[model samples]
Target: MKTLWDYTIVLQPDNNGTFVAYVPAIDGCHAWGETPEAAQSELENVFEMIRDEYIEAGQALPDNVELVASHAR
Candidate 1:
Protein backbone atom coordinates (compact mmCIF):
# COMPACT_ATOMS: atom_id res chain seq x y z
CA MET A 1 0.00 0.00 0.00
CA LYS A 2 1.38 3.40 -0.96
CA THR A 3 1.11 6.35 1.39
CA LEU A 4 0.11 9.90 0.48
CA TRP A 5 3.67 11.03 0.97
CA ASP A 6 4.80 8.57 -1.69
CA TYR A 7 3.96 11.03 -4.45
CA THR A 8 4.11 14.78 -4.98
CA ILE A 9 1.02 16.43 -6.34
CA VAL A 10 1.16 19.75 -8.14
CA LEU A 11 -1.98 21.81 -7.78
CA GLN A 12 -2.35 24.95 -9.84
CA PRO A 13 -5.17 27.28 -10.68
CA ASP A 14 -6.32 27.75 -14.25
CA ASN A 15 -7.42 30.98 -15.85
CA ASN A 16 -10.87 29.53 -16.39
CA GLY A 17 -11.79 29.53 -12.71
CA THR A 18 -10.75 25.92 -12.12
CA PHE A 19 -7.89 24.08 -10.56
CA VAL A 20 -5.66 21.39 -12.08
CA ALA A 21 -3.80 18.72 -10.20
CA TYR A 22 -1.29 16.14 -11.42
CA VAL A 23 1.46 13.83 -10.33
CA PRO A 24 4.67 14.69 -12.16
CA ALA A 25 5.99 11.13 -11.98
CA ILE A 26 2.87 9.48 -13.40
CA ASP A 27 1.78 10.09 -16.95
CA GLY A 28 -1.92 10.81 -17.41
CA CYS A 29 -2.48 10.89 -13.66
CA HIS A 30 -4.35 14.14 -13.24
CA ALA A 31 -7.69 15.78 -12.46
CA TRP A 32 -9.39 19.18 -12.46
CA GLY A 33 -11.99 20.81 -10.25
CA GLU A 34 -13.61 24.09 -9.29
CA THR A 35 -11.36 24.54 -6.26
CA PRO A 36 -7.95 23.45 -5.02
CA GLU A 37 -9.51 21.11 -2.46
CA ALA A 38 -11.80 19.65 -5.06
CA ALA A 39 -8.93 19.23 -7.46
CA GLN A 40 -6.88 17.28 -4.91
CA SER A 41 -9.83 15.08 -4.07
CA GLU A 42 -10.31 14.25 -7.73
CA LEU A 43 -6.61 13.61 -8.10
CA GLU A 44 -6.78 11.02 -5.33
CA ASN A 45 -9.39 9.09 -7.28
CA VAL A 46 -7.32 9.27 -10.43
CA PHE A 47 -4.20 8.02 -8.70
CA GLU A 48 -6.02 5.12 -7.05
CA MET A 49 -7.34 3.92 -10.40
CA ILE A 50 -3.91 4.11 -11.94
CA ARG A 51 -2.33 2.41 -8.96
CA ASP A 52 -4.71 -0.52 -9.22
CA GLU A 53 -3.92 -0.93 -12.89
CA TYR A 54 -0.25 -1.17 -12.10
CA ILE A 55 -0.89 -3.67 -9.32
CA GLU A 56 -3.03 -5.99 -11.42
CA ALA A 57 -0.19 -6.12 -13.95
CA GLY A 58 2.34 -6.81 -11.19
CA GLN A 59 4.19 -3.55 -11.48
CA ALA A 60 5.46 -1.19 -8.84
CA LEU A 61 4.52 2.46 -8.73
CA PRO A 62 7.17 4.80 -10.00
CA ASP A 63 9.24 6.59 -7.41
CA ASN A 64 8.48 10.23 -6.89
CA VAL A 65 11.04 12.77 -7.96
CA GLU A 66 12.72 14.64 -5.16
CA LEU A 67 12.03 18.35 -5.35
CA VAL A 68 14.60 20.59 -3.70
CA ALA A 69 15.15 24.30 -3.69
CA SER A 70 18.70 24.99 -4.77
CA HIS A 71 18.49 28.68 -4.00
CA ALA A 72 16.62 30.95 -1.61
CA ARG A 73 15.99 34.65 -1.90
Candidate 2:
Protein backbone atom coordinates (compact mmCIF):
# COMPACT_ATOMS: atom_id res chain seq x y z
CA MET A 1 0.00 0.00 0.00
CA LYS A 2 1.15 3.47 -0.87
CA THR A 3 0.17 6.47 1.18
CA LEU A 4 1.26 10.05 1.32
CA TRP A 5 1.18 12.84 3.86
CA ASP A 6 1.92 16.50 3.87
CA TYR A 7 5.43 17.12 5.16
CA THR A 8 7.72 20.08 5.24
CA ILE A 9 11.47 20.19 5.56
CA VAL A 10 12.98 23.44 6.66
CA LEU A 11 16.71 23.84 6.35
CA GLN A 12 18.37 26.19 8.76
CA PRO A 13 22.00 26.92 9.42
CA ASP A 14 23.47 25.62 12.63
CA ASN A 15 26.33 27.08 14.65
CA ASN A 16 28.79 24.54 13.26
CA GLY A 17 28.32 25.62 9.66
CA THR A 18 26.11 22.64 9.02
CA PHE A 19 22.44 22.60 8.13
CA VAL A 20 19.64 21.20 10.18
CA ALA A 21 16.40 19.99 8.70
CA TYR A 22 13.17 20.25 10.59
CA VAL A 23 9.94 18.44 9.73
CA PRO A 24 7.04 20.45 11.09
CA ALA A 25 4.33 17.82 10.74
CA ILE A 26 6.25 15.39 12.92
CA ASP A 27 7.14 17.04 16.18
CA GLY A 28 10.79 16.74 17.19
CA CYS A 29 11.62 15.04 13.91
CA HIS A 30 14.82 16.66 12.77
CA ALA A 31 18.13 15.91 11.08
CA TRP A 32 21.45 17.65 10.51
CA GLY A 33 24.21 17.28 7.96
CA GLU A 34 27.12 19.07 6.39
CA THR A 35 25.23 19.46 3.13
CA PRO A 36 21.71 19.92 1.89
CA GLU A 37 21.73 16.52 0.23
CA ALA A 38 22.59 14.76 3.45
CA ALA A 39 19.99 16.71 5.35
CA GLN A 40 17.35 15.69 2.83
CA SER A 41 18.41 12.06 3.05
CA GLU A 42 17.93 12.16 6.78
CA LEU A 43 14.56 13.76 6.38
CA GLU A 44 13.52 10.87 4.15
CA ASN A 45 14.29 8.44 6.92
CA VAL A 46 12.30 10.55 9.34
CA PHE A 47 9.37 10.47 6.96
CA GLU A 48 9.42 6.68 6.83
CA MET A 49 9.46 6.51 10.59
CA ILE A 50 6.46 8.79 10.85
CA ARG A 51 4.63 6.82 8.20
CA ASP A 52 5.18 3.56 10.03
CA GLU A 53 3.96 5.05 13.27
CA TYR A 54 0.84 6.37 11.68
CA ILE A 55 0.05 3.00 10.15
CA GLU A 56 0.67 1.17 13.40
CA ALA A 57 -1.64 3.55 15.21
CA GLY A 58 -4.42 2.78 12.78
CA GLN A 59 -4.44 6.25 11.26
CA ALA A 60 -5.40 6.49 7.62
CA LEU A 61 -2.70 7.94 5.47
CA PRO A 62 -3.74 10.27 2.70
CA ASP A 63 -3.91 8.98 -0.83
CA ASN A 64 -2.09 12.06 -1.97
CA VAL A 65 -0.77 14.90 0.13
CA GLU A 66 0.29 17.94 -1.74
CA LEU A 67 3.03 19.99 -0.14
CA VAL A 68 2.79 23.69 -0.74
CA ALA A 69 6.28 25.10 -0.60
CA SER A 70 4.97 28.54 0.27
CA HIS A 71 3.20 27.24 3.34
CA ALA A 72 6.43 25.77 4.65
CA ARG A 73 7.70 29.26 5.20
Question: With candidate 1 superimposed using the best TM-score fit, by how many Å does residue 25's alpha carbon deviate from the native?
Answer: 0.7
How far is 34's C-alpha from truth in model 1 (Å)?
0.1
Most lDDT-accurate candidate: 1
lDDT of 1 by residue, 1-73 (tens): 8844589888899889999999988899999999999999999999999999999999988989766657767
What TM value does model 2 have?
0.66
Highest-TM-score candidate:
1
lDDT for residue 11 in candidate 1, whole number 0-100: 89
Candidate 1: which pairs clash? none
lDDT digits (tens) for residues 4-66 of candidate 2: 225545788889999898766566568888998798788778777877987899986444333
By TM-score, how accurate is candidate 1?
0.85
- Model 2, stretches more than 4 Å misplaced? 1-5, 60-73
Q: Per-residue lDDT for 71 in model 1? A: 79
Candidate 1 at 73: error in angstroms?
A: 13
Candidate 2 accuracy as lDDT: 0.70
